[model samples]
Target: MRDWLIQLRKERKLTQQQIAEGAHIDRAYYAQIESGTRNPSMAVASQIASFLNINTFLFFPEHLSEPFTTALRNSPIIVAHCDLELRYTWMFNPHPDFNTDVIIGKRDDELDHNEGTIGLMKIKRKVIETKKPIRQYVSFPLSDGLITYDVFAQPIYNDGNQLIGVATVSTELLT
Candidate 1:
């Protein structure tokens, strides 16, 4: 079942009929979607998501395919998602100095207060504000030395095309 959808609906005190009316869909169809029995098309998903004030991507399957995830696991690349506030939401293949436990729910500035961390935060903020993708280099100081990474950041949006967060992919540059 789409537990998240149910939870959101309950939280908003909205019934399936209410949601269906708002999205201009049939109540039964909405029920099927909530029960995970029927997948909605992109247009239908967008309408429902807009009415529900959530991201349309939530109705889709996994964002990354299995093959891509498998390759990413063995690659020396970092992938991360952050909320609009720049707090880390999810991450994979973090640098040696940091782990998921240390990063999740924390902003870059919270983890380290240096020029590099500050720069990274600025870049993320720009993406959120401009709703655009960016590619740049960022560096961080560690016990060993300074590490540079080629970073790409993109703004994530909800069904209404509202900026919600940022997603980043970074590769450590070997000197």
Candidate 2:
């Protein structure tokens, strides 16, 4: 989730500081959201969505059937997606290093940037096995000096409605 938020923000070329200012939030606090340590208020999510020109529901897709990549360009939270093979395919957020040079076609699971999020992997496996949408919280530490964030997860499917992967969105709780 945190990863996805990072991906979304980067797609727009917006820095964390820029998103913070746009959402009327502190840059540090927004960093926490990207790091997978905090849970943001719904109001915060809405503020971010509005600022990014995306529907808030895309950030928390309860019935995720279509890919929300186009809508995520301006998303404030980091988002990520993994395929049925349990390989990570996407992550969106504001972290500078996460640009196309790092991700895109890479395997997210073996990537060092994953930051050791074991819980998220387990939940994703369960979702794939059950063929149902799931929501949960996952967190990861950012070495750049920011608290973790509470990530939100759901399932994404292909055109035939076959469970394909999982999508996540992360938000930071303002401390």
Clashes of 2: 24
Instruction: Output the worst ten-in-a-row residue range by lDDT, candidate 1.
Output: 52-61
Error of 2 at 111 (Å): 1.9
lDDT of 1 by residue, 1-175 (tens): 8776776677568999999999999999999999999999999999997676555666764666788778877576998888888977567777778865466557898888988899889999999878889999998897769988899999987569877789999998998
TM-score of 1: 0.61
Candidate 1 at residue 151, lDDT? 92
Instruction: Give the alpha carbon lDDT tens digit for every residue of 1-175 in model 2.
Output: 4666787688769999999999999999888877767666778877776575444444454334445555655555677776666554555553443563355434445444455356667777887787666666555555654445566677887669877677777665444
For each candidate, the alpha-carbon lDDT, in order, equals 0.82, 0.64
Model 1 residue 33 CA deviation (Å) reads: 23
RMSD (Cα, Å) of candidate 2?
14.5
